[model samples]
Target: MTEALYLDNPYLELVEATVTAVGTDGGLYVDRSIFYPQGGGQPGDCGSIEWGTGLRTNIKNTVYSPDRSSIILIPRGDQDLPQLGQTIIQHIDWARRHALMRMHTAMHLLSVVLPYPVTGGQVGIEEGRLDFDLPEGETVERVSANDAINALIRADHAVTTEWISDDELVANPTLVKTMKVKPPTGAGRVRLVRIGADIDLQPCGGTHVKSTGEIGEVHIAKIENKGRINRRVRLRFGPSAESA
Candidate 1:
């Protein structure tokens, strides 16, 4: 089993790890990893690993092994695979991941700004979007949503994480906000992201900024009607198109 170091500290950029196994498809499985796998609407981390003889492998992407037991780091193109038990230092692209972290945390605030059931979402470094199920006759203006999220950002709400057993989560069903993407259960426990003392709380495995302040300036770029009750809100870093 690979120890996912990112879960403990998403800010960690590098760590020494031992290559535990190599797949036939040329993917490297390390004993530990800071690389986030592609899932939960977040793309996998991309970086490089260095080992003996000044050799390095550029990781093109990361994904879970079938059955989701281990994270396999796929090399860029046909790069040589690390030997089993080889010691190497894993490095994540901090610039890209930091943006992702900021965007992801901001999305949580977006859900709060709208306060609707999340139908779908995507987290990106440049932008993020959340599809919400709005109440009848309800509507969200881009400027209003942007202001609400920016208020939270300036408030600098503390972001924290904790774990609860599956049984505990069962007793509190409302803790879940996303309707389509269910939190991975049956692992005995679920990871929950809590913002501020009361701003938000929900089951999420995605990495996030340590505080809302780190998210910086963000704005609702657009709000599209996906259906009678579904509205897709897109968010971008920095000022919005209208403001720019």
Candidate 2:
């Protein structure tokens, strides 16, 4: 199994690791990796790997192996592959990753502002969105929800993470907000992200900023009706145009 350095330090931009194995399609497997594999509605990280006298390979995407035991760093189609046993430095695209972290953390706050069961979500660089399961006839006031989300961001609440046993999570089912995707269990433990002292707490494996203030100015760009009870709320970076 590859050591997932990002889980412990999302801010880690670069790391030196040994090439442990090579995939059938030229994907590089390192003993340790800072690249986050795509999961939990977040996209995989893209960056470069450097080794031996300025030799470098552009990594197009990161993902897990078939058995999910190791992280594979996929190189660009035309890029050269690092040989096994080679020592290389992995560099994550920090700017892109930081934006993702901020957007992901904001998604958590959106859950709090709406206080509805989450059905799905997608975190992006410039925007993030969450689908909520609202009762029929219930409606979200766009401007007010937008204001509330911004207020939380301006609050500068600290974001922290902790580990809980799978059994403990099972005991407290309410800690999970997403109805369709459940936290990965059977691994003996699950990771939970908490914002502020009590702003929000739930099982999440995605990366996030250190504080809500880092989320900066955010606004609800749109609220779309997906189904009878599914409401999709889109959040964009910066303030709403009307507020500007």
**Model 1 stretches astray by more than 4 angstroms:** none
How good is model 2 by TM-score? 0.98
Q: lDDT by residue for model 1 over 62-116, one digit each (tens)? A: 9998878899999998676679999999989999999999999999999998899
lDDT, residue 50, model 2: 92
Which 10-residue window of candidate 1 scores lowest in summed lDDT?
73-82
TM-scores for the candidates: 0.98, 0.98
lDDT by residue (75-144, candidate 2, tens digit) is 9998777799999999999999999999999999999999999999999999889999999999999898
RMSD (CA, Å), candidate 2 to true, equals 0.8
Candidate 1, residue 49: lDDT: 94
Q: Cα deviation in Å at residue 73, candidate 2? A: 0.6
